[model samples]
Each structure stands twice: as structure tokens, then as C-alpha cells.
Target: MRKLALIILVAVTSQTTWADAVSDLKNYLSSTQSLQANFKQTVTSQQGKIQNSSGTLSIQRPGLFRWIYQKPFEQLIIADGKQVWLYDPDLKQATVKAMGKALESSPAALLAGNNQFERNYTLRPLPSREGIDWLEATPKQADQSFNSVKLGFSQGQLMQMELHDNFGQTTRIYFSALKINPKIDASQFRFTPPKDADVIRE
Candidate 1:
């Protein structure tokens, strides 16, 4: 028991180190203003096989984003910095929430919203994925959903992220051909629900 405790202590202590991890990832982000990229998302349920899809993701500072999934299905998750719209065509339903109120402090809050990554999380390279570098981020304060957040960056672009839920499901996101600070339209974040679509507000 004593030896196991020591091992856990060392692991927890190293996560908050500045010179090694948290600072290194912060240094990388300070150089970029905005980012856009294409991504392929794979979601596997607790007892299900892997499902794949491709999409385009765009992000701008101060909380604005557009996610248009083009493969496997047509879905849209748009955040206009003030409100969020999640539309799924197959279901013909839309979910809506005001910005900064939903998503329970998502990592994109680091890219476009007003949250500071350095203050909320510590950084460390994950050992799980081969040929991929990762950053493990833990929130500094309370009121976060997941215990840890993982960011995968390759070639200096935000390539992947995995949010591990307490229940054991991981939401993995991957990016490709990222374009930094591209000219994105403001209307991309705007929302107009389709007629007869169930609009739920939280």
C-alpha cells in the first residue's frame, strides 16, 4: 500500500509542473490567433463498434465555431459565441444552448472562448497513443465534467482531442489540413431552426 501511494503521488505532482508541460503547450498556443481544419470523428459506444465520419471545423477568437459533418451523415454544431445550435438532419431535431452555458467548459473554450488554458489545466504528454504527442489537461477549479482532457497536436496544429468521461467513453476528435486564422464569416455561427424541429433550451 505504501509503495502504491508513493507512485500515485509522484504522478499527480508532475502534472502541474510548469517548466516541463503546462508552459510548453501554452508557448505553442501563444503564437496562433485563429484556426480552421477538417476532421474525422470516430465514436464508439460502451458496447458498440467504431463509427466514422468526416467534417470541417472552423474557429475564431472570442467564441465562434462551425462544425459541418459531411460524411456518414449530415450534422451541424455551430456556436456563434453567444448561442449553440446542434442540428441533426436524420433525426430532424435541433438542440440549442447559449454559449458559455452549455458544453460544461469544453476545450474549444481555449481556442475561441474566453477561458485561459494555463489557469484551468496542466499539460503532459500522454503515453497511450504511438506516433502522436498529447497534452493532458486538468481543470484548476471545480465544476468540470471529465477528470482530464487530452489534446493531440501534430506538425504544430491542433489535430486531435479526446475527452474521457467518468463512465469510460472517450469522445475522440481528429483534425487535418488546418488553416490558421482564415477569413471566416460571422454568419456561420448564426442559427435558424428548421420548422417543426424540437428546440430544447437549457
Candidate 2:
């Protein structure tokens, strides 16, 4: 189970480095105004001694995302690219981000207008395998939470990911059953408060 969770996390959020040859990722990202993919995640802490809960991630480029935790307890986190919304069913409470990016180094930020993402980070390309290309990025910015992020792509579609924190803690995710360019409903990115839910504006 520990292995599975870790693998899932690695697969869903995998990123490391990439080759600038052909603007490899830039081209694929440029082709679509919006995109979405599924993800599985495992987080290990204590310098890689403990296994954290597994979860799924839903991503919509240009600043919309949903991360759902399916293990341990169910929790929902929605970010419309600008602000964040977190809902924990067990607690029946939601935290609203009045402002600011909680996860500023979020990879989805790459989906935003091209601002030379490499300015704040160094990028490298890994050899392709299993029909998927890999890239590892190391952020130069000091305020960010994690040490590095790895992204995986299969024929231009993001398939998996892995994130390693400063403490040697790693979170891996795998994307499966992916669907791109679907007729996404309007309600997908919008987050409204739930009745009786606490709204904290930070």
C-alpha cells in the first residue's frame, strides 16, 4: 500500500527537467487555451520515512484546479488560479482565501501567460521513455515551499507528476483515465460557499 501510494503520487505530479529543443512543452501548452487531467498522489515525510495519504488532482489550465483527497479522510480544495477554497467534509468547514496564492509555485502557473517561467527556475529535459517525456524544474525563488517539481507528458498531454519538498519529503501523483478538450460545464471552476460553512477570508 505504501508503495502504491508513493507511485501514484509520483505518476500524477512527476516533473524533473526538460530539453528546450523544440520548445517541447511550450508548443503543447500553447496549443490549448485550457486543459484538464486526472492525478494520483503520495506524500512522504520525515525525510522519506513515512507515507502520507493518497489523493487525486483535477487541473484546468490558466488557474483553475481541484485536489481531492480520497484516503484517510475526504477533503476538497479548489483554486480558481487567483484564490483558494478548501473544504473538509469531516470538519464541515471551508477556508476561503480572501487573497494571495497559497501554493505560489504551483506548476499550473506555467499555464498562465508565458513570462519566461525559467526566470525563477532552471529547466531540464529527461530522456523519453514509455512514450512519455519528462522535465524536472528547480525553482530559484526562495519563498516557495518545495525544493523541486517534476512533470511527465505523454504525447503532449500531461500524465504524471512528483514534488519533493525541502525536507526531503516527496509527493508523487499519477494521472489516469485522462480526458482533454471535453465539454466542461460552467460550474466546474466556480466555488460557492456551502451553507453553514465557515468562510475565513485571509
Candidate 3:
């Protein structure tokens, strides 16, 4: 009888812990309107190919963001509320896509998208690890570039994200010096291709 009671108690406690983690994530999404941070991204391929890059990120909720990669090569991805632009300075090329199509089932959707989490993803809490509470979100859509995403939070602040892609690559991003709800200039989200650059519209 004591053993059975102990098992039941443990299960209940585990469930409550998971629920709390999910709640923390919801509160964070609701409270954060704009955010800026320095980010480091590491990608590991199935064959063990690894690449590391560092960048700065800025986001305004409901579809506005600028992601800049500074190391190794310079690349910029900006969402101007209506269109998403990807520019490669070295290649002198830019690609444009509608915001909805570009962000659908993507990590950018989770961060800078409208607060429609449940509509696009099925979220669940993961076991706490490395001093962070983790949450896993699987996209509901059948066609997605990524298989799943994991978000790690420390003290309710986002710390890390892992995206498992369909191409058998895992991209992990660590965010530091995060400023939540900070004042961000609108120009940050706007992008214009250089006059000499080749622009490809998708």
C-alpha cells in the first residue's frame, strides 16, 4: 500500500511540474512584445558536419524581425510585416517571400509571430535539464522544414532553442543579453536591397 501511494504521489508531482513549465512559457509569450539579443548558432548535420555562427537579433511581435549574421559570412534576414527578405552581402543577392509563407511552421513564427501558438503547434513540457526548463513544440502542419523545436528557459527567460530539421540537421541557438520589451526602431525591421544587388522574388 505504501509503495502504491508513493508512486501515485510521484506521478502527481511530475504532472504539476510539467504544467508549471508550460505556464511559464505562456506568460513569457504574452508579456514579451519586443526583444533584442545576441545569439550564437551551431548546426550539426547527420554526417557530423558542424558549423558555428554568431549574430544579433531583434524582434517586434506580430511579424517584424531582423536577424543578422556577422561571423564567417554576413547575412541578413528581415521581416517587414508584409515581406521577408534574405540578403547575402557576399553574393550580392536578395530573396523576397511573403511573410506568411516564409514564417509558416518556422522558428521565427514562434518568436515574432502573432500569439497563435496553439493553432500552429502542439506544445508540451520537457524534463528540466542543465538548470533550464524545456518545452517541445511540434508543428501541426504536414509540410515543414523542421521536425520539432525545443525551447529552454531559465527563470522564465528564454535561454536556448534547438530546431531539428527535416534535412537531418540540428540547429541550436543560445541567446544572451536579452532585452525584453525594449524600444526598437521601426527601421530595424525594414530592408531594402542594394541597387546593384540581384533581387529574387518568391
Who wins the lDDT comparison? 3
Best by TM-score: 3
lDDT of 3 by residue, 67-159 (tens): 999998999999999999999999999999997654856788888987778788998778778778888999998698889999888888899
Q: TM-score, each model? A: 0.78, 0.74, 0.93
- lDDT comparison, 2 vs 3, better candidate: 3
Instruction: State the lDDT at 157 in candidate 1.
Output: 54
Over 4 Å off in model 2, which ranges? 1-23, 47-57, 98-104, 111-116, 127-131
Model 2 CA RMSD to the hidden true structure, in angstroms? 9.0
Off by over 4 Å in 3: 1-10
- Candidate 2 lDDT by residue in tens digits, 1-202: 9999998876554443244322556775566555555556777776556555656555565566677787878888887756778888878788887325435455656543234566656877666667778787887776677777787777666767778877778878787776655555556667887798877776
Clash pairs for candidate 1? 63-112
Candidate 1 overall Cα lDDT vs. reference?
0.71
Q: For each predicted model, how many residue pairs clash, with residues at least 3 apart or on different chains?
A: 1, 36, 0
